[model samples]
Target: MARKLPSRTTSDDTKSARTRERILDSTAAVLSRKGYSETRLTDVAEEAELQSPAIYYYFKSREELIEEVMWAGIAHMREHVEGVLAALPPETSAMDRILAAAEAHLRFSLSVSSYTTAAIRNSGQMPERIRERHEAERAKYGRVWRKLFKDAADDGELRDGVDLLTVRMLVIGSLNWAAEWWTPRTSKIDNVVEQARQLISNGIAK
Candidate 1:
């Protein structure tokens, strides 16, 4: 005879979800502080105020937990970026709007250091489903960049013969890599943001 499976009541499911979120949040903190190379499951458990074994009840392994945390971070980033882009004035110059978007992205990334770091470093290790989710959001971000670059080129803002793809990757890659060493005491984000804007504008300015 086949065995009967247990059912989850509504309240139990809600409580379970809350616990899982707490663990994932704690894991993000640990990953941010220690990075993927040095982070441990026990450290995460301690951060979550749970026994190490209890963690397995939610996540089957360290890899799985990391994946979950990475996805969460990516989702948060996507929402913030999409929201900012959506709020831009229709008549804003593409170059100026792009700079504003860069500033917003850097601000959000630096403010949520752990999540940003986790999302960037663990991106390659994400499961296919998680990867697709992130890719979809990233594609939306790409559209904004494409529009900015194309408009700038068309408007005689960017230098003739400039490769838009190369420019886009360099500008965005540098900004995304900022989460690695950004610190509350010494990192001047606004200045860095302006510098990044100037760098891109000067490099490709017509």
Candidate 2:
């Protein structure tokens, strides 16, 4: 059999994909530093080391760019949490799974990934159409949490009278809030995770 090789179009497609990622990364950095209202395509282009007009080749408008950045952030967060859950041992208890998920959430939020930080801080400022698109991505992440909580409840790990939906909201709300106040200089991520785990376990565990 003859060896297969990538076509010229495939190579061009790879380059185009890389350029789009570069634009999104630059946009995330700008959004984190300048916020959504203040960030401009010029800033993204400068950060990406491309001409301002080049950004439009990948994204049609500022709204489209911001929306893509926000969607990427949410998707990244969801993947991180899912990876953590998947890595747990099959024998892991429901409480342990919840703790692992919480730790993963906190660690990602505190890391230098500006995409998630931008998403956390600026998502609400997006235009209604963009916001709706972002929310759809966010809802997928929410379902992951709901499943974890629902499993915990079914296993009798959660306290009576505790609603799984409310627990999901409260847990995610607390984790998201850490993006605002958490700093490596003032507090450690592990310590913060431990504290959160303890508080949650005490509240929800039977």
Candidate 3:
């Protein structure tokens, strides 16, 4: 008789998926606290409350786990930005749309999730291959902002002779840097958003 293949039920698959998500969540938490070099599979496993070897079921190595965590953050941020842009009223001005996008980006970056903060702070320490992969995802994320700025410039909303690329970089760099110093107790997200909006709009508004 031929050997029979093992089978998995819906409940089994659901449990497996949940476990994987838990592992990823724990990975993000550990990375945010301990960083890449100090973080180990054992730390993630302890955080996840599973044996260290169990992590292998979800990821091959520590680097792979960290890469996945970073990718998840990028994906979530992209979806949020796209949704915010899509929800704007059809009659909204280009500058308004840009400000709205900035607000959304800043809000999400400051939220409870530390995935984005960890990724931004520790990307330089990632291995060469993993860093390249993360950068590829970041490049794709940059295109969204590029299009937003390009559309505004094309619509004559931006000041004459403005370099769209430089404007995009400065705006994004400012937002990303908030991961380092922004705190809810000292500065409100709304206040930061308005300040950024005023800065960008003043510089580029026609």
Best by lDDT: 2
Residue runs of model 3 more than 4 Å from their true location after superposition: 1-8
Residue 180, model 2, lDDT: 76
What is the C-alpha local distance difference test score of candidate 3? Answer: 0.86
From the highest lDDT down, the ranking of the candidates is 2, 3, 1
**Which digits, one per residue and each the tens of the lDDT, describe model 3 over residues 52-141?**
999998898888999998877777787888899999889988888888888888888787567787777687788888876678878888
Error of 2 at 49 (Å): 1.8
What local lDDT score does residue 85 receive in model 3, on the 0 to 100 scale? 90
In model 2, the runs with Cα more than 4 Å from the true position are 1-8
The residue pairs that clash in candidate 2, if any, are none
Name the weakest run of 10 consecutive residues (lDDT summed) in model 2.
105-114
> For every model shown, what is its TM-score relative to the native structure?
0.80, 0.90, 0.90
RMSD list, candidates in order: 6.1, 2.3, 3.9
lDDT of model 1 at position 162:
89
Worst ten-residue run, lDDT, model 1?
Answer: 121-130
